[model samples]
Target chain A: MQKSRDYAEWYSRYIDDELSAEEKQAFLKYLDENPQEKAIVQRLQSLQQNLAQLPPTDTSEGFETVLRTRIQIEKKIGYGAIHTFFQRWRMPFLGFATALVVFLVFSGLKGIRWDGMPTDETAVNHASMQNSLSLPASNINYTLDQFIASPSYSTDAASIHYQPAEDETMNKNQGVVVDSTGKIKQETTKTIPENLQLSY
Target chain B: MEGREEQSKGKKPSDEELIARFQQGDIYAFDLIVKRYKQQLLNFVFRFLNNRELAEDVVQETFLRVYRKRHAYKQVAKFSTWIYTIAGNLSRTELRRRKRRKLFSLSDIGMEEKDYEIASDEFNPEKYTNTVMHEKIIQREINKLSSKFREVILLRDVQGLAYEEIAEIVNVPLGTVKSRVNRARLRLQEQLKKSL
Candidate 1:
């Protein structure tokens, strides 16, 4: 029992030299009784001795100076850069701007019409005339009634049939008579051949 | 009256206090902490890595981490334990990195032998050859140790940290720390005995 307690106490005190005298005596007696335990203690003591003999590592000279400089630089740069970058642009604003730019880019790629394309007013007027000519005489009455209701349509019936061509000769040669309903009616003169078909 | 006496005695401010002051912009206090622990930290790293320059870098990195994390420090454990934990983590990372780089690069295969030769050449010629040889043997034995056991032995035997402190640093139980240290010391002694 004494030997067991002695060994346990020695094991605890082996880490530091705070062992009391009685504890040391008891441990010695325990070691004498237990050869295996004695061997273990000896090994531990040698290990301690070797650890103590280890040379002190040197860390002087420019090491501290360099370390301090690095730390200061890291602190200054790390916090400030993140803060400055994030502070300048809120995430939502940046995301919105990015989305807008991407949308413009893709839309441009797909050839969305811009406001600057030339308008063919003459072509549009010709297309409208063609559409009116293609309609049946009954639909023409309804369309005419709607067009007259609009303030932009003129009230003169003769003016509606007479669209002045750019060339005066072409208009006379064509001599195409269009009714109020915009159906082109050919008028035959005795001088002109009956089989002659004129088309505009 | 007791408080006044305690103040009059002026017990050194604990590591946590010093760290708090450091976080509050007391650079001198930090400097004192560094001065106090740099050698031990360097020694710990040097033994673990077996490379002086790498050890120095690890020590610097450890201190930098500690300083950066100063604000998060609680006084739950000793400051030494915290600092050691940082060192251990950094050293382990460095070791892993080195292993990975070595596996990929394969350029420095013979560098350790060359370094050993260089180290031997730099030693004193006349008086301390045996001591130097003994140190080299010990260094080789330490290198042979598994990293976990090596760390335990280093923390306990070389650094003189308590088992509890080591447990905190290693994030293990006190019993584990003691057992690991004991096993590592035994292994080291066995190796030394065989060499002798």
Candidate 2:
């Protein structure tokens, strides 16, 4: 006689016809010797038959049409969701993105240094220009008047000579021509001939 | 439809062949596949969930998944196994959702009590009513089984699938599938005996 556990294993296989010829013969012998196992098998078989005979469940009417409509609606909703999302935020997002790109490009061109160092040689030149404008040393032996009378200043002033042209209309008075405000004219204006007047 | 019939006349294509045709852009082949398996899948899922609406939804989702993922169906596996796997996965997801809802809703407790009241309220407390009532008892017992045993048993007896196909659908070894089916049957039988 077979144990209930072993019979449990063989019962499904026997019903399914999966047992080999030798196994089937041995299972039959086991069932014959064990009335309890035979009764169990009989009960299982009856249960299987009852289950198989249960009322068939037909699908509802228009099932395929409903499924097709659902699929169509789903596909549309999927595509429409993406389209609506882009439509809603496209301008703002594009504007923000464009501003960001522009800001990045210009900032790259301006080259903001993040490492606490100067970005260009112009900073060094600025420092030197600032240094040149500082007050002279207090220990200097010369006053402001003496510094103004220095040879370098005198020569620099003399190099800039003002030569007046031959004035056709005012050639009669050439000695320190002064009329308005009694001030000596540095450069007298030359009168151009009527035929030589250039159109500016 | 006529074009499809004429294209593959006088011989019905296998599930794999239909699937292959679907992958190659034959829309009618997909229709054929859906028609072939819709009722079977509906019955399987209905038994698993014990709810008609939910079963229909699962089967519909299963076909939609099959349509969307037709290209993923390789020729190495049987089409029935692949489609059954999809249906089973959807059913499991539904079950998990139900479990979550039951956990969160106090009303579900009341609903369960009502269910018991309904089950207990037969024509007479002393006698079995009709075949329908008996089938209800059987269904309740089947549902009472743990999901693993319930799944293997339903796939075996109710769906009438081979052990090998069940193994493929459940993604387990053939031996494991066989053992589970046997154990499920034995457990179901014991439950029925106790109820009797």
Candidate 3:
């Protein structure tokens, strides 16, 4: 009793108004020619109507009131949870936070030593540079004099000889010079430990 | 005052506009959004879930989420899709919960596999009278459908959402959504014809 193939597809689209105007006209013409197919369209329409007419279920009265109260309660519970969190862990959190802040500030104010505190050589170099920059030239000279006057100052400049490395040897003559310097370095090594001890 | 004038002039703002206002912390706008969606969501959820109480609970939870997550709504998305997605997810969760409960109850009672399908407290035939028998039949057929099919039909035909919106709410490809809706409708049509 119903049309077949493309007409059937058109029937579905026709009901939904999804068919093109030309398709709709052709479909209507097919329906007019086959009156029995009208029942099919009617059936589909009735189904759509029935579905739309299916009893709408509304929330009971005071729905908003109940919902509002519930939202309020939920908000309160949420607020309470956060409040309790702060209340319960206030001191510990404060302590941890304070400790973290203090650590950060201290680390910021004091220089960051990549390998912990500076070694004696670096500290001495830093102190000397700071004194040289900050003090008057006369004061720096006086400080240098006091530093040299110390018993820790090693005055033997020849003992601090630079030995030409093996690769740096000019010739066999250079080897003789390096041999003598090596002896001088060996002799000064014993006295250098005493100077380091006094300097520390 | 301008909004009031527009309301008096018979032009209503769109859902997106209302949601945008709500996002700006307008309490009245929030109330309007809730009022607008309450009944529609109730109907959608009631059909999805066959119980009034459960449907109402889900709607309540849906609204609760809307209130709680108002800021999560992006202006790029339709408010309807966002709210429907929330309701659909809640409905799916309730269905899953019911399924687990049914399984546990069936095991507890040592029931056979056949009775397991009919073991829900919701299947009271007494409530489906002669007057509403057709509606009851339709509801029963819908309930008999798989969740995916049922949800697609409900969203498409019952709620009259566009296929694109349904796809967005269900989080499926557009082609998949269209096919599911067509298949669901065909299946429902067959059942409806037989019942008639």
Candidate 4:
């Protein structure tokens, strides 16, 4: 009933049952004296009663079972380990390892040039050209220019010219090349004739 | 058997003892802790969120957080204080997330009346008959209170926490908790009177 100026303190003490016998008596006397405050107190009592009457919440059914299962499953999945490790070290470790890897790989590959490697198509074409250019022993003296210029040379003939350079001769006096040393030479060139035209 | 009786009588384990046992992977000790406070925790969280499933989720998350952070727990504060702090933080976070997600439409909350009716029916048949009307009034009034006042009321009246514990749980001064609870109770009374 708010007889005292400190209604909040009185209410709090009343709820906790901390008021002394004399204080509670005085408070009840005050409530009896004030009609509006008595009404308010009545309302508060009703509210408390209603709150008390509210059903007790049922949390027992399968709650602990579910919790135990969850906790077990969580433990199986490294419960706090993953979370704790990540919280403490993930960012720094990830950053350090990533930087270390980048540094090591870059340092090791410093002189390597990936762009310089021949493409697959070019390597395959080159290997095929080398195979097709295999010539007979009788035609070994014919220069690649003469062979390419020959009237019999057709589209069916592989467009590769194999030449033995002069310095590559087995017998300098004979000016002839021999396979005794198994020596071979190769050159590749792509050309467009003057009469050919291209559209962009 | 004597010690087990004392333990069952709720002679709370010392923080160091609990911590040591938990560190040794004694989940039953953790279970004891959970058993001691789970209902109160559920009530606190349920009042905050007003949804049972969400409240249960918050409780689970709170315990999980506590378990994860158990190693960091210091004895400077009471274990209940630390646990409630975790629960309060998680509840606040979930509330904020719910706000951001905009998932709590008025229509969604309206559906709760039906659920409450269904839930209350299982408790007591006679009480359930009058529960709907009274519950609606109480729920509406409680919902009208500011979050601060609502929290104090729920903690003090519903959860039956002491003023000091409420202060620790809400992370406010003890005086503030007392004043808030008183004011909230007064406001609820006023609202109830009006509804009558």
Residue pairs of candidate 3 with colliding backbone atoms? none
Tens-place lDDT per residue, model 3, B99-190, is: 88877784645432332243345445443322223566677778778999999989888898999999999999987887787667667766
Screening candidate 2 with a backbone cut-off below 3 angstroms (N, C-alpha, C), the clashing residue pairs are: none
Clashing pairs in 1: none
What's the ranking of the predictions by DockQ, best on top? 1, 4, 3, 2
**lDDT of each residue in B95-168, candidate 4, tens digit only:** 78876666656665556445434343333433422433366557667767887898888777766667888898
RMSD of each candidate relative to the true structure: 16.8, 20.1, 15.4, 15.1
Give the better candidate number (1 or 4) by DockQ: 1
Which stretches of model 1 miss by more than 4 angstroms? A1-37, A79-200, B1-12, B113-133
Interface RMSD of each: 4.3, 3.9, 4.5, 4.0
Model 2, A1-200: lDDT tens digits are 55767666889888888899999999999999888888777767766766666565667788788888877887878945776799899999999999999997666556546554444433422332233223232311211221222312112113211222334223334332333333223343222233332121
Give DockQ: model 1: 0.26
Q: Candidate 3 chain A, which ten residues in sequence have the lowest lDDT sum?
A: A186-195
**lDDT tens string, model 2, B58-80?**
99989988987899889888888
Q: A165-196, model 4: which lDDT tens digit per residue?
A: 33432322322122333232333222223332
- Compared to the true structure, candidate 1 yields what TM-score? 0.58
lDDT of 1: 0.68
Which portions of model 2 show Cα errors greater than 4 Å? A78-200, B1-3, B7-10, B110-133
> What is the Cα-based lDDT of residue A36 in candidate 4?
66
Better of 2 and 3 by lDDT: 2
Candidate 1: deviation at residue B36, Å? 1.0
